[model samples]
Every structure is written in C-alpha cells, then in structure tokens.
Target: MTTFVLFGGTGDLAKRKIIPALYSAFVNGRLDANFSFIGVAREALDDADFRQRVLASVSASIEGSSANGGGSTPATLQAFLALTSYCKIDAREAADFEPLKQRIDTSGANAALFYLATGPDLFIPVVQQLAAHELVGDNARVVLEKPLGRDAQSAREINAALRTYLKEKQIYRIDHYLGKEMVQNLLVLRFANSFLEPLWNRKWIQDVQISISEQVGVESRGDFYDHTGALRDMVQNHLLQLLSIVAMEPPVNANPDAIRDEKVKVLRGLHKFTPEEVSKHTVRGQYRAGAIDGKPVISYQAEPGVPAASRTETFVAIRAEIDNWRWAGVPFFLRTGKRMASRSAEITINFKPIPYSIFGTNQRNLRSNRLVISLQPEESVELFLKTKEPGEGIRLSDVALNLDFAEASTSRRVESYERLLLDAMHGDLTLFVRDDELGAAWDWIDPILSAWQGDSEGLKSYISGSWGPAAASYLLAQCGSAWGEEYVED
Candidate 1:
C-alpha cells in the first residue's frame, strides 16, 4: 500500500483541494484500501479533528460527479474520512520530523509521496527534514507545486537545492492545468483526429488565442500577488505550457519523453522578444474600481498589502511567436487578468480564410473557420464553420458545432489535482513539466520582464469589470484579429 504525506496539511490548498481530492479518490476505491494518508502541519491536531476538517471541507462543495450524475453522499463521505490521520511537525526543523518518521515506519509502506504544499522557500528545507528522518526512501516521490521561482535564476537555484536530496526522476513538478480533462483532450483533439493535423500550421492557422481570465481580485492573497504579478504567476507556467501543447509537433508516441520532447521543442522555438519588440507585443494592466454584475468593487491598489503606487500588473496580454516552420508567422496571443468581466479559460485557433472566396464581392468580410477549446465555464469544444444562411441570396454565416465533455463522458470526471496526484503516485511524468521546459519558458519570458522594467510601463488601468486595457484589443487588431465572444452576465 502506498502512503501519502502532505506537509502544510492544514493550509488552504490542503483543506480546499488536496484533502478533498484524496477523499473523492478514496470513495471511488481508486486508492488502495491499505493505503494511508498522513497530514503534517505545525498545528497540533489529532486524527479525529483532521478527519472532521476533511469531512467538513469535502461536504461543503456540490461538485457534480460524472459517474453517478449526482453529488457525494453521507455514506461515501464517511467512508473516505476514515482513511485520513494527522501529525504535528515544524517543516523548518529536521528534528521535528521524528514523530512523522515514527508514523511512516509504523505504517510499513515503502512507497511514499512527500507532497510539499508549502511556499517555494520551504521546499528545500522540507525535503532536507524528511531526508534527515529517513522518511525519503529510494522509491519515494516528492511533489512540488508551482510559482517555482520569481525568475529563471531563482528557479535554477531551487532546482539545484532539490538535486542535493532528490534525483530529477524522483521529483514531480506539477502544473495542475496539464491534469485538466480538457487539457489532456487537447492532444486527442489535435493528434487522434485526422481532420485537424493537416491544417495545424502557419499556412492554415491565422492565429491562436489563449486567455485565462478571473472575475475576482486578490481578495486574500494580495501580498503574494503583489510580488509575482500576472506574468510569472500565470503566463510563464500555465499559459506557456498550454501554448506548447497547442503548437508542439506530434510526439513519436504518447510516452512521457515523447510528449515532453515535443513540448520542449515548441518552447525552444519560441521567438525571443527584444526590448522594442516586447513593447509592441506586450501590454500590462491593473484594475481600477468598477462594477462587476452591478456590485461595486475596490481597485487593485485598495487590496490589503498593496501600495497605492504598486506597479504590479493584475492583467497581461502578449503576442508571442514560434520561429519554426510549422508556426513561423502565426501569432499566439496570450492574455490573463484578474477582475475581468467574466471568468474564462480557453484556447481559440483561428484558421486562415479560403484562398479566394468563390462568392468574392458578395461575401466580403465573412467569418473564417475557428476551433475553440473552452476549458472552463463548462468544458467543451466548438468548431466554428461558415455555413449557408437560410433564405439568403448566397450569404454565409458562422455557426458552432459543439461537443460538451461533461455531457458526453459516462465515467466520473476526475478533478485536475486528483488525476495529477494519482499520476505522481504511479510515477508518471508525462503531465508534469521537466527542467528543460522550465528553463526554456523562463528564457523566452525573461526578456519581456526586463523590457517591462526598463520601459517603466506603469500598469495601465482598466475598469474592474472589463476585458483588459484597450491596448490588448489594439494589439490583436494590428494583426486583424479580436478576442473571441465575451461571456455577458445577465
């Protein structure tokens, strides 16, 4: 039986996502019955208290289960709660791990996963502490969450620190987005289906748009948000990883190295942005007070721990390019923001218009074909094709052929973290980002960060309930493009 140890187990991520995910997995019998979960935190809580917390957290959310077409029941909840236990230990001190070591030794499971859900700074120390207690065995795996570092050098430092205790294969660097059902489907949508492969290039794809927008500001994590900004927090990891998946060449096989090899190639092909080029390709914005669904909200500056003069961007938009044959001139537009008009995460692939319209003069300004993979606000894929307008004199209109994954899949849809955690247990590195990928991503993104600082591009302000700064629209307009349909709330 495999044992999972969660450091910082009483923290928000543990309570809200990790524990709940474990519960769901446990209830479904995906986790072995002999398995044990040992949560370690500074807080002194007994096993019963920890179980109650898990029960409370899991029961609060009404997540739709794809398996039953219903929510979790009290019986299922109780059964899952039985698998958990807690231990109190300070992650910083190696000596504090004695109790945790005793618990693991007693469990008698050689296969263990040491999940560091704490901040990045503590990652190394936690591993060292675990190593001191002999809790990190030869077969054990260590999982580290994102925001790996503030920049490339820092990331390397973290990697170097980890290497002192763990090997590259033993470390699982998770990017939860990769675990999402829709994200995994991206490969299937591109490679499995023959319809898209031939046209998946600069010759046929006019441009691609990747947007990850949030409707809420940094209500609680203002301090953390102030330092990281939109670029490092979202673009460097989440958005860039998505771009690689969208633009990468077909892997030799679906194996870990095969898939990651193609992704690395995509990252390497990224056209590095010069200072002047950065100015043209990027735009940063900070949200100002405005109404969201008729409710007045505070500006980013008003948030706790944020100074009035803070230049930290709440929004960012960039037009990136891959300098390879497959995607030479095609622009990949990436945008992410907080306090946007609506919450959405999607990728839109705009196919080039036909060589010459047969109904040329009459059918001017007709919409081109588009493939949209919506990751949130319900996961679905839509193919927007030009269709004949009914009762029209040779008119054409665009309509979507949509496929909703939630409605189609009969099996239970696993949460992103749930699938990823299981993968970590099974030692699957396919969905996790490797060091080379990380370095390449930072290499491509570093110049943009430097350009922003050198240019002193103060955060351009946009209304709270808006798409982003006007410049974002103009950035796309220069390429004769625009954001896909916005979700308007009633």
Candidate 2:
C-alpha cells in the first residue's frame, strides 16, 4: 500500500488542481489499488466532510473538462473516498503533529508521499515537525510546490533549511509547467529529432518567444498577487523553466540528474541583466478598466486587496539572452500577464529569413519559418512553412502544418499535477526541479527584482482584454519582431 498525505487539503489550490488531478489519476487507473490519501489541515472537518469536499472539487473540475474526462461511477467514487481520511492539526504547533504521526504509523501503507499544498512559510515547520516526529524516512518522500521564495537569497535559505531535514532526493520541487504535456515532449522534440537539433541554435533561429497569458484577473488571490505581481509569480518560475527546456543542450542520457544538469547550465547561462539592461530590455504593465467579451473589469490598482497607488505590475515582457555559445546573440523573449486578450501558454521559435526569395508581390508579407508550440487553448505544435500559392506563378503564402496533440491522441492527455504527483510517489525526479536549478533561476531573476524595486517608472496602464501595454510591443519592435498575435501565419 502507498499513502499520500496532503497538507492544506481543503484550500483553493487543493480544490482546483491537486484533488482533480488525483481523481483523474484514480479514474484512469493510474494509482495503485492499495493507494491511500490523508488530508491534513486545521479545519475541524472529519473524513466525511473532507471526502465530500474532494468529491465536489473532482465533480466540478471534470464538468469543466467534459471533452476530456469525468469522475468514475458512484461505486468507484465511493471506493476512492474510502481510501481518504482527514486529520486536524495546527501546523504551527509542533505537538499537534502527534495525531498525524499516529495516523501515519497506523496506516497500512508501505510508503508515503507528503504533498505540502500549504503556504511556503509553513514548509519548514511542516517538514521539521514531520522529521521531529520521525514520521518521514527513507521510504517517504515530499513534494513542495512553487513560489518557493521571493528572491535568490531567501530561496537559498529555504533550500538550506529543507536540506537539514531531508535529502535532495527525498524532496521534489514541483513545477506544474514542467509536467505540461508539450513541455514534457519538448525534450523529445529536440533530442529525439535529428533534423531539429542542428537548426535549434542561433545559426538558423532568429529569436524565441515564450508567452503565458491569462484572461482572468486575480479575483481570489488578490492579496497574494498584489505582493507577488507578475515577475515573481510567473516569470521567475514558469517562464524561466520553459526557457530552460527551450534552450538547454542535449543531455547525455535520460537520467534525472543528467537532464537537470543540462537545464541548470541553461539557467546559469542566462545573461544577467544590468539596471540599464533591465530598463531597456524589460516591460511591465498594470491592467486598467476594460472589457473582456464586452464585460467591464476594474484596474489593477482598483482591484480588491491592492493599494490605491500600487506599482505592482500585472504584466511583464522581457528580452532574455543566454551567455553560452549555442545561443549567443539570440534573444529569448519571455512574457506573461493577467487580464489579457485570451488564455494561452505557448513557445514560438522564429527562424531566420530566407537568404534569397524569388517569389513576388502577394509574398511581400511572406515571412520566415516559425514553429508555434501551444501549451494551452489547445496542445498543438504548428510549423509554418512558406509554400507556393496554388494556381499561380510562383506566388507564395505561409501555411501551417499543425499537429494538435489532443486530436492525434486516442487516449486522454495527462493533467500536469496527475503526472507530477505520480512521479513523486514513484520517486521520479525527472519532471521536478532540482534544488540547485531553483537557485540559478532566482539568481538570474533577483537582479530584475532589485532593479524594479528601485525604479520609479511605476506601472504602465494597459486596458483589460488587450494583449498588454504598448511598451510590450515596443520591446519587441526594438528587436524588429512582434508578438505572435501581431504576426499571423496562415
């Protein structure tokens, strides 16, 4: 038997993501038959209440993804619930963990996986309590979620503290983005294909763009978002992790550390931004009152939990470069924002222009080749290639060769958390972040944080439903390129 313990089990993250993923894994028969899940939180709910809540979350999530899946039948759902139990413990009070220790001891499971969905502040205390109670051992593992810390030094401190109680192998720093289907397939797209590897460098590629846009505002996590903003909240982790996968060299082998070692090299190769570089190479914007699907929305400053004069940026666009030879002189544009045109997470590779174009007129708008890997809105990889317009004299137009993963697959796509959680249970660190890599990412991001903190440019106001501020476009214009939205490939 294997047991999974969830801290902060009834919270929003758990409800919206973790539980749904677990249920999907269950319905899909991904979990072991002897699996167990124990929900831990300060709430006074017993097993029945927590089970009902999990059922609700699973039901709601599955309803939203009707095209993809739903929960199992009543008997199956009840059987899954039977594996669930709840424990009430104030994480701050060490002695309160005795009950949790007893629960783990009495659990018939041969191994345990602790998932800390609680706030980062409680990470140390929770782990410390577990270690103190001797509740964790060689057979037990723990998964720590993101927003690890605000900056490099603090992240280091957290990493150090975690090391005191747990070995690096025992800790899984989960980045849901890494577990994304396309993101996971990225390594395959590069290493598995001989044709792509040679052109993956600066010689054939002009620039790369990674953008993650959100149509929704911070309605629920306003207080948390106001402090975090787009930089620490998105760029520091998700965007950078995506960048690493896009830029890393071919790993010698598929061993977890071997792949991560290559990834860390990409992180360390990031060209650290100077204050002037930060000013010129970066753009930040705050969403103002505007419409989405014609519905009105308030400005970031007017959002609840936000200061009236907040300088917090809800959008960020950066021109990042790797200092290594493979990518030198090639700029990787990273962008993300809230209250944007639509929700999409994608990585785009812009190839260099043709050395010679004999095609005329209608081809005036013809551009170089581009590869768009969409992570959301749909999972697809679209390659845009210039082709002669049929029934015409050498007329050229760009056509997309689309490979939509969802359309091509006979089976359901694995949810990020579902894949990641199972990896944690199996002690697979391939999809998880290594401790050192986290520090390297923060080290690259911290300078920008410092520069933004000291700068007085304030936040640029962008209308909601728009892509972002004009400056975001301007940042790209300086590099003689634009966002994927501005340049459409047929």
Candidate 3:
C-alpha cells in the first residue's frame, strides 16, 4: 500500500490546502483504494478527534467552496476519513518517531510519501528523525514546500542534508504555481502549436511582463513576511519559475528532467545585476495606509508583528533580461506586491509594432499585437490583434481571441494543491523544482538581496490600494511598455 504522511498536519497549510486537495483527489477518483494517510503533528488528538477535524475541513473545503466543485458525497468522505489517522509527535523529540514508524509498519505500507508542510527550520529535524527510525526507505518519496531557505548558501545546506537521506529523484521540491493549469499549458501552448514557435524569439517579441499582485496585506503572516520581504517570498521562486517557463528553450523530451534542464539554463543565463544595475533596474516599495475595495487598510509598518520602523518591502518590481540567444534583447518585467489595486497573476508578452503602418499616424496610437495569459482571479489567454472597424472608412481597432480555460471546460478544474499532490503521489517530478534549479534561482536572487541591504534609499512607499510605487510604472515606462492593462490617462 502507498502511505501518505503529512508532517505538520495540524497546521494552517494542512487544514486549508493539503487536506482539501487530498479529499478532492479522492472524490475525483484520482486516488485508489490501497492508499492511506497519516497526519503527523504535536496536537493532542486521537483517531476520532482527528477524523472529526478532517470532516470539518472537508466540508468547508469541498462543500462550502464553489471553486472546489462541491463534489463530496457522504459515503466518499467517510471512506476518505477511514483511510486517515493521526499521530502525535514533536519534531524535536527523536523518540516520538519510533511509534510513528511502528504505526506505518503495522499498516503494511511498503511505499510511503512524506510531505514536510512545516516551517523551513523543522525540515531537517523532521527528516533526520524519520531517517533515524528507518522510516525513509528507498521507496519513500519526500515533498518540500518552498522558501526552502532565505538565500543560496542556506538553500545549499538544506539540500545537502536532504541528499544525505534521499536520492535526487526521490525528492520533490514543490512550487505550487507550477501546478496551475495555465502555467503548465505554457508547455503545450508553445510546443504543440507550430505557429507560435516561429514567433517565440527576440525578433518578434518586444517585452514580457509577469506580475503577481495581492489586494490583501499580510494578515496572520506579518512576522514571517516582515522578515522575508517580497524578494525572497515571491520573486526568488514563483516569479523566477514563471519567467523560466516563458523563456526556456524547447526541451529535448517531455520528461521531467528534460523540461527542467531547459529551465535551469534559463536561470543560469539570467544577467546578474551589479549594484549599479540593481539600483537602476529594481524597485522595492512598502505599502502606506490606503483603502482597498472601499475599506481602509493599515500600512505595512502598522501591521501587527511588523516593526514600527521596518524598511521591509511589501512590493518589488524588476526589469530582468535573459542572456540567451532567443531572449537576449527582450526585457522581462517581474512585479509582485501586497495590498495592491487587485489580486492577480498575469504574464503579458508584447510583440513589436509593424515597422511601417499604411493607415497613418492616428492608427499609430493603436497598441501592437500581444499575448496575455492570466493565471489568477481567472485563468484565460487573450491574443490581441489589430482588426478593421466594419462600417468605418479605414479605422483599425484591437480585438482579442480569448480562451477562458475555466469556461472552456465543462469539467471541474483541479486546484493547484490537488494537481501537485497527485503528481507527487505518482512520482511525476515535472511540476516540481529540481535541486540545481532551486540553487541557481537563489544564486541569482542573493546579489539583489545584498544590494538592497546596503542601499536604504532603495525602499520606496506606495498607498496600499495603488498598483505599486510610481517607480514600478517607471520601470516599464523606460522600455516604452505598460503593465497588462494600464493606460496613460489624459
């Protein structure tokens, strides 16, 4: 049987995402009968208590949320609960793993998957304890959540420790953004479509803008967010991973390593920002008090658990360029922030305008043809093209060939956590980040971190409800391109 063990199983992540995902997978027939689950945490709960808790979580997740498709029947939910049990063990207590080992062995579970859903500090300790108890068998696969470490050196240490206990193939370092349907569609969108491959290079594409904005400020994670900042929290992993997918070469094969090999090359090819370049190319901002959706919100410094004098950035915008043949001249604008105008994740590929427009200067104001891929708030792809206005003398207008993924499919869409969990269970590492890829990403991010520390003037401030600091707009303006839908009003 395949046993799935969740460390930190009583935490917010487990309650909010992991459990709901697993139960959803079960409901959709993605999990077989032989599979079982064990929830590991220090919570003082027995089988009954934990099962009841699981029931509440599943109800709220599957039944209460429309996005999850309300697919759970009583019989299936009970069956899923039957497959789950709880184990109380403190990660620091080595002896606690002994009983957990016995429980797994007693269940006759031969293949096990351990998911470390805890903080980064507990990752090594939990793995070490599992190793000492002989719980990390060759058939066992381990999954790690992100913010693997603050920077490259720390990331290397964590990776080195995992290497001592597991093989590279056995480790699944997850970045949940990758498991999104549209993000994965990037692969098929480029490779399967013959028309796109010819235009995917620098000559046709002008600038690429990838931005992830949040309308909500750091709520309960203020302490963590204050320490990590936007650079490490978002840009280092999610934004960069997205950038790699948008800029990577066609892999030799669709195999996990083949796809990841191309991604690593993109990371390695990223132009390192010198201190001068960092000041010129990067903009970091903290949110000041403002309203979001007609409600007042506090500034980042005024948030609970954040320092009153903190210089931590709630927003960061970067103008990045890949030092590769296909993307050498193209600039990638990456931006992420908290308490922005809206919650969105979008990638906009702006194509160059026609060298010669026969329609005259009035039509010159018309934007160029470009592709817009929206990842959140909705999942859709829009290709903007210049079309003639019917009934007009000789007028041109912009029209979009839009494909909304959610509306296009009748079936329920799988959530990111569900997709990633299923992939881990099946040992498909294509959606997971490899060790080298993680290292290279951090290596590229570390210099920017250092530069930010030495320059106090680098941190700017913006109203909470605004897109970001004005400097962010200027970053893209310098290249003569705006973000996805921004306009210069009269």
Candidate 4:
C-alpha cells in the first residue's frame, strides 16, 4: 500500500489541479485498491468536510470534462472518496505533523508520497517538520510544485535544504509541461523516426520558435505574478524545459538519467547573455489595459493586489542560442506572455529555404518547408511543403501533412497532472526536473534578470489580446524568421 499525503491540500492548486488529477487517475484505474489520500493544510477541515470538498472538486472536474466528452460513475467516486481524509497542520508547529504521521502509519502502508503544493517559502519548513517526525522514510518521495525560487541563489538554498532531510533521488521537481502528450512524443518523434533525424540540424533548420501564449491575465494571482513575472514564472522552468527537449541530443539510452544527462548538457550549452546583448536579443513587456475577445480587461498594475507602480514584466521574448555542434548559430525564439492573442503552446521548426528556386525568378513568394508541433488547443504535427498548383505554370502553394493525435489514437489521453502524479507514485523520474537541471536553468536566467534591473527602458508595454510587444516580432525579424502563423497572410 502507498499513502499519498497532500500538503496545502485545500489551497487553490489542490482544488483546481491536484485533487482533480488524483480522482481522474483513480477513475481511470491507474491507482490500485490499496492507495489512500490525506489532505494536509492549515484549513480547519475534518474528514467529512474534506470529503465534501473533494466531492465538489471531482464533480466540477467531471463537469468540465463533459464538455470534451468524458465522465465518471457515482460508485467509483464514492469509493475513492472513502479513502480520503483531511488533517490540519501548521507547518511551523512540529506537533502538527504528529497527526499526519499517525494517519499514514495507521494505514499500514510501506511507502508514502508527499506532495508540497504550497508556496516555496514553506517548502523547507514543511520538509523539516516531516523529517523531524520520522515521516520521510527511504521509500517516501516528495513532489515539489514550481516557481522553485525567484532566482538561482534562492533556488539553491531551497534545494540544499531539501537534501538535508531527503536524498537527491527522493525529490521530484515537476514541470507539468514535460508531462504533456506531445512533449513525451517528442522523444519518439526524434529517435523513432529516420526521416527527420537527417534534417534535425543547424544546417537544415533556420530558426526554432517556441511560444506559450495565455488568453487570460493573472486572475487571482496578482500578488504572486507581480513578484514572479513571466521570466521566472514561465521562462525559467516551462520554456527552458521545452527548449532543452527540442535541442537536446539523443540520449545514450531511454533511462531517466540518460535523458536528463543530455538535457543538462543542452542547458549548460545555452549562450550566456551579456548586458549589451540583452537589449538586442531579449524583449520584456507588461500588458496595458486592452480588450481580449471583445471584453475589456485591466492592466497588470490595475489588477487587484498588484502594486500601482510595479515594473514587473508580464511578457518575455528572447532569441536564445545553444552553443553546441548540433545547434550552433540557429536561434531559438522563446516567448511566453499573459493576456495574449489566444491560448496556445507550440514549437515551429522553420527549415532553411532552397538555395536557388528552379520554378522561376517569380517564385519569391514560395515559403520554405517547416515542421510545426502544436501542444495545446489541439495536439498535432504538421509538415508544410511547397507544391505546384494544379493546372498552373509551376505555381507553388503550401500544403500541410497533419497528424492529429486525438484522431489517430483510440486510447484515453492522460492529462498532464494525472500522468505526472501516476509517474511520481510509481517512482518514474524521467519526466520530472532534476535539481541540477533547475540550477542550470536559473544560472542562464539570472543574467537576464540582472540586465533588466539596470535597464528600465527595455520593458515595453503591450496591449491585451496581442501576440506581445512589437519588439518581440522585431527580435525574430532581425534574424530573418518569424513566429508561427504570423508569417502567413490571412
């Protein structure tokens, strides 16, 4: 039997994602009959109260999934709810862990998994209390939710503190993006296919564009977003993780460490930005008052809990280069922002143009071949190729070879959190971020943060429902490339 303990179990993260994911896993038969869940938080909720909350959360999740054609049975819901109980724990008080320990011990479970869905500030204290209570046994693993720290130094401190109570292998630092279906498919797409391997190089590839745009602003997280910003919030973990996967060399084997070893090399190979290059290669912007979907929205500063004079950036666009044999001069255009044109996350690999067009001198409008891997709104891979128009004088038109994952597979697609939770429960570390990987990411990010501090003029203002600041497009235009879909004429 394995006991799953959820810290900050009543918080927004637990309600919106953690608990719902756990229930989904259970409903999908991924969890065994011996499993149990304990929700730990400062909220004064008992077994009944917590069960009621879980019912509501699971109900809402099932409702949301119905929109996409899914549901659950009442019997299974009640069965899973029966295994759940809540315990209130004040992390600062060592005695608070006693109840949590007793609950787990009573279950006669040999292994346990602790998920800290709380703020980073409470990470060390909660782990310390668990260690002091002898709850972090050898079989017990701890799952940490991100924004690991504001920057490198603080991240190291938190990681070092975690090591004091747990071994390196026991810590699972999760970045949900890595658990996405297409993200994992990237491994197979690169290694399993023979056709793409030959063209996956700097010589054939012009520039790679990785963008994650959100249609909504910081709804209730104004305070957190103001302090964290897009660089630390999005770029540090999610975008860097994506970049590493897209740029990493084939691992020696399929082992977790083997894949991570190559990812670490990619991170280390990232070209460090100097103060001068920062101005030319990176663009930071804050969203001003604008309309999204024809609905008016507030600016970042005007958002509740955000400071009126805040200088935090809600958008970040960077032209990153990996200094390695495989990537070399090829630029990785990385962008992430809130209140953007639409909610989407994708990677577009633009292949270099033909040296000389044979169709005619008038073939200037012939677009080059490119591969697009869309991760959200839909999961699909599209290969754009220039073909001759029918009954025309070698007139070329762009056509796509699309492979939609949902249409191709009959299996039930696992959501990111659900998949990650199941992996953590079974002790699979491949999809989780390692400590050194986190450090290397922060190491590359720190210089940009420092550069932004000294140059206030670099922070541009962009309206909501836009791609980002005009400077973001210019950053790529300078390199003779553009973001996905922007290069096309509607």
Which number leads on TM-score? 4
lDDT of 2 at 74: 77
Q: Is candidate 3 or candidate 4 better by lDDT?
A: 4
- Spell out the clash pairs found in candidate 1: none
Local accuracy of candidate 1 as per-residue lDDT tens digits, 215-302: 9898877888898899998999999999999999999999998999999999999999888898889999999999898999999999
Which stretch of 10 consecutive residues in model 4 shows the poorest summed lDDT?
Answer: 63-72
Provide the lowest-lDDT 10-residue window in model 2.
357-366
- Alpha carbon RMSD to native, model 3: 1.4
Each candidate's lDDT (Cα)?
0.87, 0.89, 0.91, 0.91
- Model with the higher TM-score, candidate 1 or 2: 2
Clash numbers, per candidate? 0, 0, 0, 0
Candidate 3: C-alpha lDDT: 0.91
Write model 4 residue lDDT over 1-490, tens digit each, in one string. 8899999898888888888899888887788679999999998888999999989888888777752125578888889899999999999998889988898888999899999998899999999999998989899999999999889999999999999999988999999999999999988999999999899999899999999999999998888888889999999999999999999998989999999999999999999999999988999999999999999998989999999999999999999999999999999999999999999999999999989877777654655899899999899999999887899477778999999999999888888998999999899999999999999999999999999999967789999989889999999889877787578633
- After TM-score superposition, what is the CA distance of residue 438 in candidate 2 from its true location, in Å? 0.3
Instruction: Give the clashing residue pairs of candidate 3, or none.
Output: none
Which candidate has the highest lDDT of all? 4
Q: What are the per-residue Cα lDDT tens digits for candidate 2 across 400-455?
A: 99998987988777888999998998889999999889999999999998999998
TM-score each candidate: 0.95, 0.97, 0.97, 0.98
